[model samples]
Target chain A: MDLTFTDAEDGFRAEARSWLEANVPAKPLPSGDTAEGFARHLDWERSLFEARWSVVSWPERYGGRDASLWEWLVFEEEYSRVGAPQRVTQNGIFLLAPTVFEFGTPEQQDRILPRMAAAEDLWCQGWSEPDAGSDLAGIKSRAVRDEAAGGWRVTGQKTWTTRGAFCTHLFGLFRTDPDAERHRGMSYLLIPLKAEGVTVRGVGRLDGDEGFAEVFFEDVFVPDADVLGGVNEGWGVAMATTSSERGLTLRSPGRFTAACDRLVDLCHRQGAVASDPRLRDDVAQAWMDAEAYRLFTLRDITDMVEGRSLGARSSLNKVWWSELDVRLHEAALELLGPLAELDGDAPAAIDGGAWMKGYQFSLSGPIYAGTNEIQRNVIAERLLGLPRK
Target chain B: MRFAFTDDQLLFRDTVRDLLDKECQPEHVRFAWVDGDGRLPQLWQSLGEMGVLGVQAPDAHGGLGLSELDLVLLLEETGRAGLPDPIVETAAVAVPLLAEVAPPELQAAWLPGLVGGGSLVTTQLGGPLVACADTADLVLAVRAEQVVAVPRAALRLERQPSVDGSRRLFRVDWQDDDAVVLAAGSVAADSRDRAHDRGAVATAAQLLGLGARMLDMTVDYVQERRQFGVPIGSFQAVKHHLADAMLQLEFARPVVYAAAWALATGDPDASRAASHAKAAASDAARFVGRQALQCHGAIGYTVEYDLHLYLKRAWALSATWGDAAFHRRRVAEFVLGPPDLPDRPSRSEEIHHG
Candidate 1:
């Protein structure tokens, strides 16, 4: 096994490191889940797009460098190492872009991708509803074909939509054939939030940010051209998106490794190695878990490079990283002690309350992207070949 | 970068696995439990003939001159078989240590015999108990930070029985006066530290195999063993437990493989990587052993059953080199700098007060 990167890849990493070192803001940006923060993040994203750093894995025609997946991973490592702002455009580029690359027509790609890379068309997922959180196939949102209007008449209410109020569009599955089975007859639609009869209300998350929203659609008109994959093939298409969300695309190993380095720094600051053996061990264990995740991803992407399918193995990645994130944050909070409760703006708050805010966000990890319970079932049934019953 | 074994490496692994499947089945393991010193001579000879014993030895010593990456999977196969031998102690740790640092006269005396199954060599790297020291032709013991190689006839061995009966642990009585000094001062310390890392990583690979084997056995048992008029595997609790076990193994395996790579390449972070692998693999195998027994119910609790063989082996090996906590603490020292000692405050203190 050759673990060394090529000279070209190392050069790519050097370029990314230098760019990020110079470009990333000295002070951390506000959380992009908020209105003001969202606007600020758009500026950052536009700078990235202008420099062809926003979507490095995408084609050059779409403002990308046409980098390999390994290079993209390198970019992520360098990006996080410099403490860059979180990608406010992740839902568009990480989750949906893969599905679009696989399913979108050339016309769709040409029209949607460049704008997406430029952060002109912000997007949020609309999968989870009030009643269909885990059982996503039980969605009751309906879309009726309107031949006269040359599109679909969509009526639905989607809840727990992350950054919905900040986004310009929604991508989700809606039932087109009501008489069909649960996973059948659903069409994946991309609906404009500014369309007539559409409404969005921002909801405060546990972290006290309007990071989530409820989007209501009342007979909104969507064009037939916005239908991704096929009219009755939304479930299959959406599964591909979920796997990307669950796998390396959304949560790169660089995020955790950087977090691990930060944790080590915090431990050093707190004199944790001298003060508490248990806490020191916990910090080290968390750091090792992050490294393990990195190693696991290298092996995973290597297999992909070798023409092997990720398949249900993405479930393993989902469960692992989500859980590791929570543990990492927990270790930080433990080091922070009672001061962890203070908010970012509070006087004497530790690291601007980043640990507490991150802990709150990490809670959503296991809950979103399919609950860990559901992922475990998928692992047992699909990967281990156990009986579903 | 490719992060997988080469085709030849995988083929060698499969060859050893197939050989173990035929010769070192559960009965072979059980037979060793009832025999003296628990040494499977024929299997050992076959592995020697396959060049498994000589994987890290130089070609001039009638060996394969391979690195740990080439030998890592073979260690896993041995773990899967619960093979009643000291292959890890002899082949993985001692042979390589001897090849790399032993004096020319000592190498000529032991290297060829050790490679060809004519002699056994075991080292006491740490702790009081030495694995297979009772039967080893040479016992490489550390005396006051110096490595001394002593023949078995010069030492006294008192067997210390292990929970895994196939493994014969012992407390050896030896002296530096009667032994030849292989290395002294800083060189000996470095050799001893390197040997510890090798043993830890080798055991980590074996733990992965043991975990996988137990998980497979439990999965097979649960499918046929029924409760409530259906297969036990149909229960969600059973499925989730097994799933969690599989998850642990899945994540741990890659770490062990990477540790092997780190050692083979002599990476500066090899010690930390080895500790990481041992900590992860020990936890995964122990967790899988618990869940595997729980899923199997009463049948798995019996020694007559084969699952206990792998479970006990995992438990024994989990604590062999250094348990999960020890390795984590070692990694903690690496990542956070050494712990704060009042007498000698290191980089940790600088970071703390700086």
Candidate 2:
């Protein structure tokens, strides 16, 4: 029933808060999807790496501080509270690293993690393709065994590869056994985008950033060492990735709480607290929703510490926080009124149109990492024992 | 950092849950709807014997001195069973406030009887309406920053027909001379405020259980009932609705637990936490109730079916302390400062929108 953090955790929070307060960029960096911004974010990422705060929850062998989960959460809260730059290295550090830790070979972990921690190697996910967006098992990517070469020859096109133009490598599912079941036959592979036959075409996102891309591979040679989990076992391994993606790894409650605080500030600045009761209430509701998510994560982390499995409950978390993110941003935009539509460059745009940009970004939350519709199906079938159609 | 109940707390909850499962089934609830008092005395006595009624009362008052955190889960069990009693009004709100702010003479007169289940107690903390006032031996009412304890004999009770037949609602009329003032001034105001929070959080926990029960009933029903030559549960639309319902309940559950913890620890944010809990739980339960009925279709609309019992109870309790909108306003005040306008719309107008 205890809710207070341990003194050590409080100390960890204080330390992280001080470090972030001092080091975070005074002005926000440009979106990392642009080349110049990508380079700028890399410096920030390296600064975090230098402080050993980049992967606080990872093992010290991989350049992390080997912090506990509670400490990691504390660090995240502090990081968000200080309004630090978005983690440009998140695709690798948060999403792929957890999978790599769980399913990567010792040699692979030794080779991959430190570089990821240092942001020397940028990784993007290649899960969704032109035909395999929500129905990910409908992946058409193939990898033929090149036994003579001691590897596989991969040929595929992966679309909606986030930050693909900027990333050096990609991790995706490729069919290795065509004859197996729909969920079977796939292999999780880590492919270098710099490889000879690989091509990347940046796709414009709603925010007008080249954050999305279509990656094409023409018989790119990948060594057997690059396969994660195992051949024909990619479905299971990728499930682990999706769970972490939907769960605490990619989106922690800290991000939303920070946004909520900003939303409250926006309301106060606009005098909406006195002018519009309904909008003020919306701001408060958003704040409370954020707090609820924070409390939810505490219970969730408690369960993890107690050795309980999250199972399909991660879907619940996904549906909640994603929608909350959208609502928080929407409230900010409501306060901005018609000026919400202005670009960051516009003089009249409030907060450099950060709320507008954020609202656009939040639109993707329900669509990516498995659509909310699909997550709902998973929740009903797996979590609530509903029958499959 | 351990945001979970201890083994002892869970054990106590499990005991009450098992007792409710055995003795307070839907049939017992149905019986209460037709019964004059809308109560099951035997079940109430069983809860008293299990120390469920006296969970927050002092040890000297024939009770188990436990915190709200220990009793909250049990309260959820009561809601799940739709136990058709004013346990939230009595055990959770009235008894605790009485134990805290009642004078020695007042405490001696009522605490033992209330704790021992020899007397029934109901309170009016939110509005003019009082629940189960007809059956309660004592009615604790908040009046102008004073907490007055009145014997049922001294009050005139006008029954107000409610959606949930298992609950007896009334508008009570009483004279100041007939009631004893338990506490006055700032102490009374503080205790009254705490009681409101307690009532809200307790109702939030109950709504969680009631929503859970409705969802379960709908899930079970959908699996058995068929449509278009297939089980209705197999329909993606039906499943999605149920999934959304489950999502609401799941997120709201943690909020309720945290609110209970905040109250138990007397956290400075207890008022806001309680309001947050009530708002979240009320919204979740109301949403789940709608979806549950939608998923069940015609069968759910009937009184013979079990879903309506929980659904009705959830609807009643959602508005019990202060409906979702009221609590949300409180949270709004906690986050954004109090509204500056004096000519704001009345509570009824706001409730209409809510």
Stretch of 10 with least lDDT, candidate 2 chain A = A271-280
Recovered share of real interface contacts in candidate 2: 0.86
Q: List where candidate 1 sits over 4 angstroms from the true fold.
A: A272-274, B343-354
Candidate 2, superposed: residue stretches over 4 Å from native: B345-354
Q: Relative to the unseen true structure, what is the C-alpha lDDT of residue A32 in candidate 2, on a scale of 0 to 100?
A: 90
What DockQ number belongs to candidate 2? 0.78
Tens-digit lDDT track of model 1 for A1-389: 98889999999999999988889988999999999999999999999998889999999988999999999999999998888999989999999999999999999999899999999999999998888999999999899999998899999899999999999998999999999998998989998899998999999999988999999999999899999999989999999999999999999999999999999898878774345878888899899999999999999899988899999999999999999999999999999888889999999997899999999999999999999999999998898888887
Q: Clashes per prediction?
A: 0, 0
TM-score of 2: 0.98
lDDT of 2 by residue, A68-183 (tens): 98999999988999889888899899899999999999999999999999999999999988899999999999999999999999998999999999999999999999999989
For candidate 2, list the clashing residue pairs, or say none: none
Sort candidate 2 into its docking category.
medium
